[model samples]
Target chain A: MGGDNAPSVVLEGVAAALEADPALKIVLCGPDEVVTPFAANHERCEAHVTTQVIDMGEHPARAVRQKKDSSIVVGCRLVKEGQAAGFFSAGSTGACLAAATLVVGRVKGVQRPALAMPLPAPSHPLLLCDVGANADCKPAYLVQFARMAGIYAERILGIPNPRIGLLNIGEEEEKGNDLAIKTHALMAKQVPGFAGNAEGRDILTGDFDVVVCDGFTGNVTLKTIEGTSKVLFKMVKEAMMSSAKAKIGALALKSELYELKDRMSADTYGGAPLLGCKGAVVVGHGSSNAKAVKNGILVTARAARENVSEIIAQTLAGSDASNSEQVE
Target chain B: MGGDNAPSVVLEGVAAALEADPALKIVLCGPDEVVTPFAANHERCEAHVTTQVIDMGEHPARAVRQKKDSSIVVGCRLVKEGQAAGFFSAGSTGACLAAATLVVGRVKGVQRPALAMPLPAPSHPLLLCDVGANADCKPAYLVQFARMAGIYAERILGIPNPRIGLLNIGEEEEKGNDLAIKTHALMAKQVPGFAGNAEGRDILTGDFDVVVCDGFTGNVTLKTIEGTSKVLFKMVKEAMMSSAKAKIGALALKSELYELKDRMSADTYGGAPLLGCKGAVVVGHGSSNAKAVKNGILVTARAARENVSEIIAQTLAGSDASNSEQVE
Candidate 1:
């Protein structure tokens, strides 16, 4: 009812997830026609019919407010009301983010929720936060983003003492504009695992476990990577097919190239979690296939099971306590 | 005597440029030992002995003022005094930018000079401005950057009626922060070929001929492209060589792959120009080879011969006249 493939991909994803985890229960929220038959077939599934659907083109905040009976809104509401442990969407990113923030609510002391996703790197995967959350951000907000992201990286990602780096123009302390300068100074003092500063190049180098920036920059970087990778792969394929000799070489290297491609694929990580929310909320690409949809639900469940939101809340509370004590 | 392989690479570049263009004259600025022998060997070469050197790590503005006898300062002074039509440096970017702004000076009515470089896109190459100058910028300054870069693309890059795009978080005019929103509004009104807003992914897709942004964002974007390309190439090579069959495939595809890599290489463009300056000042990478250095000189000479500085000054004057007329 939401994504490009809609009910078919969604149903397959739910079925796969339930099959993998015997104890898992799914409450599918969509039109009665789409959800009723699927729910009736699966013993562990429950159908919750919705009257409306939010189009991807509609304004996110307005759509969320007006379409209370929309699948996205109802799904998030279930989490808020304790009926569901988490909410997952392969729908509009803005709609999902809006619904998650407005319906599921945010963890207290979090200024804004951010979407954190793993970026493929040389040594290991790096977590990039605020991928498409708050476009305009204050220095204090970035400090909080770093703290929350660090906790998630540590608790959920199983990376103890995750190093946090401020995304900036240069690695030097005095290199960026007012906002970056202020954020760097605050992060150094406030965050325990602050790893100086990370330039854009450093983000994908696996130099730091967590990198934080304003949503605008983070979103731009994410898209740029996606676009570049697409073009690069296309160019490589075209080059390989340009001549018989190249085609032979390409065929020979097919298996190895496939492995590399798999490593860089976003589908491997499922979906980006809308962090700082009280309940786990994950948003996948609109064009997500069955595997991606299944992975999205799995990641969301992992985040919820580990109590990622609670860990972030406790970390923020500790920082607030320290700040108040310093004031006294 | 700048760059990683200074003196040797610089000398070879100068020799190559002279060999290619017999009419071209070079004024080599360095210490006596380095410049004297090189200048003595070439009929079109002149030597200007300098007493000091500016290390890449030195503070740019301070060193430029104190080390007036340094090659960077001396070379820029020649342009300022009308002894040379342009200055090219394969030295520290900060020093080159500082010297260009302080010595060569800015165009009339130009608030700040910017560094403009061509990024290799999927279609044709596109111009990106403010890559490393003016880190923090006002909306008006970005409008100026767009205007100047547009002219550069039309005149130098030979793209008539080049489309100008404001880089932002989203493609929507209303989808950005304070600076982006203001810049988009102004650009839509002011620029004749304004194509509205462009996202980060749009930059590499060859959607716009000239994309303008603040230096901080531009610099980060440039580095990210470089880093991503480097990693992508490595991954492809690794994949291709994973087995004997792949090795044969990689060999067959070698020539085609080289062509693709060449198209994306920064060295193909020679150097980035510090636009809005009174004189042509081109800055190359620190690790520039002999060919890159020669190309940098060739590019600087072309800009000077075309009187790009004069054209920019006149354009700025024209805009000022129109603004005043509207006010009246």
Candidate 2:
């Protein structure tokens, strides 16, 4: 009810997720007409009819507060009330983030919750935190983001002692804006696996496990990569069509090219996790297909099973204590 | 004297530029051994011997102030003294920027000088302003950057009424950090050919002729595009070599692929102009080859011929008058 292709794609994705995992139970929250039939057809499924839907264009915080019976809000409420272990939405990113923060709440000691997306590097996946959460951030906020992202990398991605890099314009500590300079100084002393500063080129080079920045820079960097890939692929296709020999070559390599595209696509990772939240909140892309929705649910399930939120809470609390001790 | 392959590559590039444009004159500035022989051989070339050389890793402003005899410093001095109309360097970016700003000076009404880079979009090249100059900028400075960039696009790129966009995380005027929000308001009221806010994805979409941002975001965006292209092309190459059929296909499309690469390469654009400076100052890439250096000189010559600095000064003076009137 929140995404571009809501109801149909969402229902199809739920069905696929159910088929993939026999023990997984889903509680659909949408209009009765949208959820009732789907829930009745599937085993271990229940319908929690929602009266309202949050549109993609609506202001996130206002919509979450005004639309009490909205699917995004109700889904987050379900997580807070212990009815659901996790919430996955392929709807409005802002609405999902707002609902998760307001209803599901944040872990204690967390100043700001961050959105962490796994970038599909050629060698391995790299997690970029605060993709579009807190745009204007303090150095302390970035340090916390690094800590939470490191926890997520270890618990879910199975990366032991993950190296965390500070996303900056240059590799040197003295080479960025005010925020980056301050954050680099703090992260050096506070973070466990601090790998110094990573330039924009290092994001997808598989040099660091997690990269942290203010939401603005991270968001711009993420979209730039997406835009560049689309433009280059279009150029590649046009080049292939320019000649008969090239067209034949394109035909022979069609399947492999598609496989490469899938590997680089956002659909492969399915969704980005909202780290520092009390519940597992995975926000899927608004233009998500059925397969993407399915993968997003699986990621949510894994986070819930691993109790990632608890680990983040404990780790942050311990770090805060140590920081205060160092001050004393 | 300057750049990674100094003396040899720089001399070769000078020769190529002179050959291409018979009316052009070049003044070689470096050590006697490096510049004398080259200048002696060329018809319109003169040698200006400088003793010291600024290393790439040296602090920008500090090094520029200290290294009076260095190639970058001496070149900018030539521009200041009217011995040369422009300066082109494939040396340290920071050193070049510092020298140009400090020696050649700034336009009368300009608040801060900006580095404007031409991004090679598929449709036409788009100019991105403040690529890596002022990291933290005021709204007024951004307005000036937009004005300067728009002029550069119209004069050099030969576009009429070149559209300008304010780079932000989102398209909405309200959807950004403190700097973006304030800049968007100022640009809408002041900037000529303002096309509203452009998201990160809009940078390459050819929707806008010129995009303005603070240097930090602009730098991150620029490098992210470069990084993404490299990683994706490597993936494409790997995909091509995965099978015999694909290998044959790659062979058929080799020339077309290399052409596409050249079109997207930094060498094609040659150099980024340091706008708002008193003289035409072009900073070539550190890894620039002979061809890139030749193109850089051509770009510098074009900027000088167009009297870009004088135009920028007049435009800014008019804008400043209007702004003061509005205040009154």
Candidate 3:
């Protein structure tokens, strides 16, 4: 509802999605007066006039009630009442997160939710979880993340035996703190199909399909990698602009340079899924534009059709060996 | 020295170092036969024949005694005895770290030694500490790392008021657990000019001059950044080579691309220093060639001239700041 550029970018995204899939359904969740004008210009959004506006400025969980007819509240209600499969937001992340947790709640046996995103590596993109969904974590939560991420990888990525690794300070089973040590033991014994300890570097190295970590470490690692990439690209840009020779050289290399830039764009990575939820919801980038939103919709649609949540439940409910294999 | 391309790379680095600096001196500490022959090839090496050959296969710390005659051990002895300003190794990190603590010893008030590296960024380089120095840590150790890293940024890079930051999982001052929270408190109380708490992305964002963390978290952050960069570079190369036009385009951009690669070279920032030691020490890349080795020596010489160790000690000695900034 209120991401970067807000209604304009989001409205364009909705249009793009409708163009690609004529039969696709959508329920916009934001201020009616603001969004109605954008929708009024669109011919495809016929007969779907539902007004429930959620203010981007409000604290999502608490102020959500204040805007009783807000878009987010309505969107969330649609999902809760079976009118929609899931909710998508490019608005206040806190609001989206609060809504996702409070509205849909957790699946049975899932203690905390994880935010999983595919790292755009040269190798097959690896899934790193707990980006910011949960701050404090227990060993059991990490183990469940491994199991959950593994199933998603197998179904979504089609990677056979999707190896699940617990992100730690080291590769040695006994090397990390009490949390890592306990998680390692549990992964080795209780969690079937565990791939053992994977260090931070291994996250993007693609040594494992899923890198499971507590929210604290996971969010830090994710941000570090992103920051590093930006700084490096900036360096390249500065170097290219430094001198006449370099500038001339950059002119000649602009295509290849941009080709590299496009590969690292956050938009290319569609969305960060709120994993282990009953519904199929995906969170697009806060700075998302038309293309990214379109991709987010498609991703969510696929997850819904694929019944990812159902698979997660069945996987967690199955036998030790079956669950273990399913975990990958 | 168990890093990628261990002995061979280490050998090339030594060769490079000896050739570059006329005032430079070295005390080789690996296997005498392995390091001596190469040492002999360089002209004016008549005064550089000292050697202590340590077994590569032996436990790094324990091997120090068995191969008391090894290069690492002997080199460490020289530093311990004040004959050399620093020890450089591209060999066993465990052995190097062990010998650094056991032989040279730590400065007063410094709990653990840290391996600090300067990662290439868009705006100047960023200094990250405790890359892989110690596994576990006390909040006190993190406090010490900030002081030591601050001194390093000052004398080496000449960045006055170097912004020292604690690499936490989150930017919120109150977000982390006992370790992060306690560390935050001490840093706020003790550090000279500290930047509250920085997230993982801040490192590459060039937001701070010195990024500090415990060995476990720091090591993970360091490696993950490296891996992500590697993967990203590879992706650019692959995209450039995917098609005929792209390949042709890449050829036009080859010079600029090479410039980018050179600017991003890990060794360009010199070597990772073993901070909080009695003397200056640098660890070149295990696979380093002549230039990296030479650069390491120059880095060590600069640190020695700047009295980096003494400044770090003084910083620790006057940690409460009641004594004010110590002048060594």
Error of 1 at A16 (Å): 2.2
Clashes of each: 3, 0, 26
Docking class of 2: high
Top-down DockQ ranking: 2, 1, 3
Taking the tens digit of each residue's C-alpha lDDT, what string does model 2 give over B1-328? 6789987899999999999888889888999998998888898899999999999899989999999999999999999999999999999999999999899999898989999999999888999999999888888889889999999999987889999999888878789988888888888899889999887788898999999998988998888888899999999999999999889889998999999999998887789999999989999989889999999999999999999999999998877765663310
Q: Which stretches of candidate 3 lie over 4 Å from their true place?
A: A37-70, A237-260, A319-328, B1-12, B15-20, B35-67, B176-178, B320-328
What does candidate 1's lDDT look like per residue over A107-226, in tens digits?
998888998887777667788988889888888888888988888888777788998999898778988878889888888888889998888888887789999988888887888788
Maximum-DockQ candidate: 2
What DockQ does model 3 achieve?
Answer: 0.46
Screening candidate 2 with a backbone cut-off below 3 angstroms (N, C-alpha, C), the clashing residue pairs are: none
The best candidate by lDDT is: 2
Best by TM-score: 2
Per-residue lDDT of A110 in model 2: 90
- What is candidate 1's CA lDDT for residue A314? 83
RMSD of each: 2.2, 1.8, 4.4
